[model samples]
Target: MKRREIVEKKKAISEIIKAASAPEKDHLCLFSQFRHYQYKGHSFYLKSGRGDKLSSILKHHIQNILKINMEKVYGSEWPSEEKSKRKEMVSPEARYIFIYETANSDPNQMSESVGGRGSQTVCANDTETIVGFVHFRFTLEEEVPVLYVYELQLEPHVQGKGLGNFLMQLIELIACENRMSAVVLTVQKENLLAMNFYLSKLRYTISSISPSRVNQLTGPEKSYEILCKVFGVEAKAVLEVIFSIANSAY
Candidate 1:
């Protein structure tokens, strides 16, 4: 990319973040069908969340879910990782899609009524309960505008029911709708299930910026790998191919 082009791209990404961060209905409205999800006998609805606006109830759920799912994976590193997660969850730029299990008679009908941007839609009833969440943000990765997923956690009871795949598909849709180059996330190398889910099920590739792709020798020492599903040739070059050249230089 040319210097001027990179500058323009950065400006564009900044504007996207600003607009998405605003308490208004816009890009999300483009895909209203994804607001509700039903799998097996379970019915759930998604709610948009801002890091700054998280209620005590939501915050409690976030922390509890993270610990339940990640403590064993992080092991000795969990204490510090937990602190980091707490701080990241509160950043003003952090955006969330919270999944709540609902008691509504027909979830298919709920999907018809809910809009994309939660700011414009009231969601769930008094009987609905929280189940899982996906935390993501609109930001730049290697000067390319992308949606970075910070976390995707589900309650233990909901695992292995294809809900993870459904949520990821929704996230990818939102990324594409917003003109993001790709959907990016990090996964611990120790978490085999998640790695297989993203790589085999979702078809995401290890990003060029991932430690292993950047330097195979020392990269394996890193506990995590960055992964992405690129949308176009430009994103593929910057996110998946750039490090191939970088590795040669190393």
Candidate 2:
């Protein structure tokens, strides 16, 4: 072929390659700025780093995003007995506990529900400033363990913005990537809004429902529903949505 024709053909191939790769390039650029971690109803960003550093940042964001008051949640004076009890529950590899205190409740009183031996009080972004928090517990039901969300809280200010859904989706993704069956959690029947959100909106199915177990929270045990969503169904849908959002951002 003539030299001029050869040059023209090469230029045409280069253009084709660029056109073929443009969409993927765009996708990467879109999601480049933010690192996302899904919780029940919120997508947490951790500025990307080593696992320990990312965990700390995630803990802080979770607490601040929910706007929880730590002092009020734990109370002015630390209950020594409760602290001692929690220390006992902490094992070598227990997941950390995150809390976003909405009401002024004693940490000692919360011990039964929130604190235990396997929990870590993760660092928050700041002191005396609160939004909400989530507590996580790790368990090995099978060969590959799963991280369970024991408690999730969001202050009044942060509620109603669909953060709960975002957090759940994030957690589901984490569970799926780890090859866990699903993220499991129990919610009180009395909390109708939460129940409705989980059942109706999130599409979580009730694996089991217990009627007010003896050591349950003060209210009429009502019913405690253990909800779960398999990785194939809900988790896949969530990842699609995240990609969609990232694409749309640009």
Candidate 3:
């Protein structure tokens, strides 16, 4: 986005944040707070990096859940002697995390009954068992402020659920509310499953800075792709202009 448009959008989003009834809506789960966005019957809780306790849990998840996926993409030699490179990647000290929770619901009870949602019946301490997490931070890409997704890791048990898409929608909502022009992330070319999930399911496009786009000759050898979803009128217009210039140069 142009500088002027960015300023205006930030101002608008700031207004929305201020105008909202509360900072975040309460979820049925006991301990989550900050921001909540529900989609397709799933409740995703987002919170800024909290304490070292949360950080430890995040690292544990990355070690057990994300390491395999990373090895699949980056090559088999990626693991450390300890079997996890998470010491470097999953940094809850900086970015916020979007948490997918586990609610041990009893099938015996009707969801519609007075007992209500299973989440209400069970006291869920999110730190102990996190189904999945997405780490993201606000950043500038081509002069446009965006939410950059560092990682989106889910436990195998939670993999097939619609929670992934729901979490992304929640991220987009966050970017839209923060006055960001888009949501962006890096995906390894070798990780076809993730590439298809973002490109086909989420409708994100290969960004101009993606190794594939910036330098095609060397691009094919690069491991990752930068993908983005541009939003708002002004942001889209700016991207079109950037693409036109880039295409002409090529």
- Each candidate: what lDDT? 0.80, 0.43, 0.59
Candidate 1, residues 1-250, lDDT tens digits: the string is 6999979867877887666566554334566676677777777777677788888777987889899999999999999999999999989888888778776747545533434343433454422377888989888888888989999999999898788998898889888877788999999988888988888778888898989888989998999989999999999998985532321111
lDDT agreement of model 2 with the native: 0.43
**C-alpha TM-scores of all predictions:** 0.86, 0.44, 0.66
Write down the TM-score for model 2.
Answer: 0.44
Candidate 3 stretches with Cα past 4 Å from truth are 1-53, 80-93, 98-100, 106-125, 237-250
Better of 1 and 3 by lDDT: 1
Q: In candidate 1, which residue pairs get closer than 3 Å at backbone N, Cα or C atoms, i.e. clash?
A: none
Q: Using lDDT as the measure, which candidate wins? A: 1
What 10-residue stretch in candidate 1 is worst by lDDT?
A: 241-250
Clashing residue pairs in all predictions, respectively, total: 0, 29, 0
Candidate 3, residues 49-122: lDDT per residue as tens digits?
Answer: 42233456656765666665566566655655234435435433325454545342332331221332223222
Q: 141-194, model 2: which lDDT tens digit per residue?
A: 322234566666766755776667766765565555445545667765546677
After superposing candidate 1 on the true structure, give the runs of residues whose Cα lies further than 4 Å from its correct spot: 1-6, 25-28, 108-128, 241-250
Clashes of 2: 29
The local distance difference test score of model 1 is 0.80
Best by TM-score: 1
Ranking by TM-score: 1, 3, 2
